[model samples]
Target: MRLIKLDATASTNTFLKELAKSGYLDDFTVVWAKNQTRGRGQMDGNWCTEPGKNLTFSVLKKMEGFQLNKHFELNMAVSLAVFRTLDLLKIPRITVKWPNDIMSGSHKICGILIENSIVGISLKSVIIGIGLNVNQSYFPGNPKASSLYNKTGILYDLEELLHSLMQNLEITLSMLQSGQEKVIHREYHSILFRKGVASTFKSGDGSTFNGIILGVGNEGKLRIRLEDDSLAEYDIKEITLLY
Candidate 1:
């Protein structure tokens, strides 16, 4: 549970990865920054953050004996942790967009990126990076982004929010270690976007469809029921969120 705070950095994830490679990062070590100059997101998109007004951090853990195919469960656990943290702050209208985006009424509040290394059938270590909009009042050009301050009209202390986030993260990781996939799975489903509602999805092969999101499968794939009542499974890249 060691928390290292940085005044300013390029990216917390990259910093932690370098530390992990140099054997400086240990299990439960958390690295955070008040501002990120070169923040990144899924698909190489830029993660926007207001200096000293957002949550940007990385958690490093050494996991062993975990199935590689179950990595999506880790995503679920982390998303649930973020959701629960915001919930505790009494932030209403927050929901988890499938895979790992935290949204509040169609505006994104947080994003997660997970990277891992494996050594001969055992997970060496995992770096879970999170970028959350905390006290920022507005985004420059991203209309789909929102912050806790914008929603609640009250600013949050960065350190206090980080403490709450780490506590939830520890609990979620413990549940994963204890084979409690059902706990995160249920929570994730409960907050899933477009649940039981018709939505448009674009697949990797350039095909689009109108389908309903039933729930994620045990293997962590998106389970969609098409208009014809046919069930289909999609990996992260296989489908794009259209809402």
Candidate 2:
């Protein structure tokens, strides 16, 4: 694994993708930026991090034997890797929000963005971008954002945390490569946020409803048991969980 550090970039994910096109990047290659001018998140959301105070990096993972249909499994693996890295630090109330948001209690501490390259049904590669709040103590626009320093009152070593994340990521990805799908599935749902708790959700049509998260399906859709006792699956854009 090769690691590159950048003083600043528009987006680490974007930079890593271009590096991969140069035929110089290998599986597990990492690109970390001290500052990202145009950080990104899932969907069209923007990930804002104080320069030099957060972990913003992208990893290039070369897919060899994985099937394209099991891409959600990759999400589960990466999410679990981050969870394990934080768990070693003994972060309390750690939970994985649906589709890979890392939260400490009610506040988000990390976000993951995965971009995959595919040809037909064959898997090619994936660029996994991670944004982790480490030393930042304030969020100007997002009230739900929090950092490790805010939660623990202790500043963490950014390099140390990145090393731990990469180690845990390797173990998790190995599980997926070895076809341990059932184990990955069970562990992911076990730490899922609000798996059985009742919550309110908003649909794309601006309608709100009460539901309980049953877990996620293999295709990465959220499964909810609605008030009418009917179960339904929703895509990422179709619904939003209102905390």
Candidate 3:
């Protein structure tokens, strides 16, 4: 893995994208920033943290002829990779909120945003952007947001964490390529937050409803069993997990 350390950037994913467009890019190349000015989470949500107190990086995953149907699998793979990295740290009550938010109990600790380049049903490459709270002590405006130090009270070496996470990421992505989809699927569902439990959700129309999270659909939609016993699938933007 080629590592590019940056003092700061608007966003690591955007920086890496420009690099790829300018020249040939290697797979698993990483761009890490000490400060990310405009970090974005899932659905354009803003992510901000203390400078040099978090992990703001993007990785390039290049592949040829990757099937379009396998897109959701890639998402599953990335989510599990983050979970594995967090697991080794012994964080308490770790769970993955659907689509891709890594939470420690009720407080969020990390977020993943993946960008893919595709052509005619074949994936070309992807930029997996991760923002993890490592040593930050406080979230000024967002009480629900937290850091590893807050959760564990142990300040971590950012370089060491990045190395371990990259290794796990590489191994997990390779496993997906090696036909280990079923295994990955099981692991991901096992750690899903609120899975198999009654939860409240808000739709795009701002109306709230109750359902049980069965699992994610093959298309990456959240599968919910409604009160009427009818199953419904919803895209990420179509539904929001309120609980």
Candidate models: Cα lDDT each: 0.89, 0.92, 0.92
Model 2 residue 152 lDDT score: 89
Candidate 3 segments exceeding 4 Å error: none
Cα misplacement distance, residue 227 of candidate 1 (Å): 1.5
In candidate 1, position 32 carries an lDDT of: 93
Q: Highest lDDT, which number?
A: 2
lDDT of 1 by residue, 58-134 (tens): 99987888778888899999999999999999997888998999998889999999988887766778999999998
Error of 3 at 169 (Å): 0.2
Per-residue C-alpha lDDT of model 3 across residues 25-95, encoded as one tens digit per residue: 88999999999999877787778889999999999998678898888888889889989999999999899
TM-score for predicted model 3 compared with the true structure: 0.98
Q: Candidate 2 lDDT, tens digit per residue, 1-243? A: 689999999999999988888885678999999999999889888888999999999999988657888999999999999999999898888999998999999999999999987877867889999999999999998999999899889899999899999999999999999889889999999999988999999999999999999999989899999999999999888998997
Clashes of each: 0, 0, 0
Candidate 3 global CA lDDT score: 0.92
The stretch of ten residues in a row with the least summed lDDT in candidate 2 is: 18-27
Pairs of colliding residues, candidate 3:
none
At residue 160, what lDDT does model 1 achieve?
91
Which residue segments of model 2 deviate by more than 4 Å?
none
TM values, all candidates: 0.96, 0.98, 0.98
lDDT of candidate 1 vs native?
Answer: 0.89
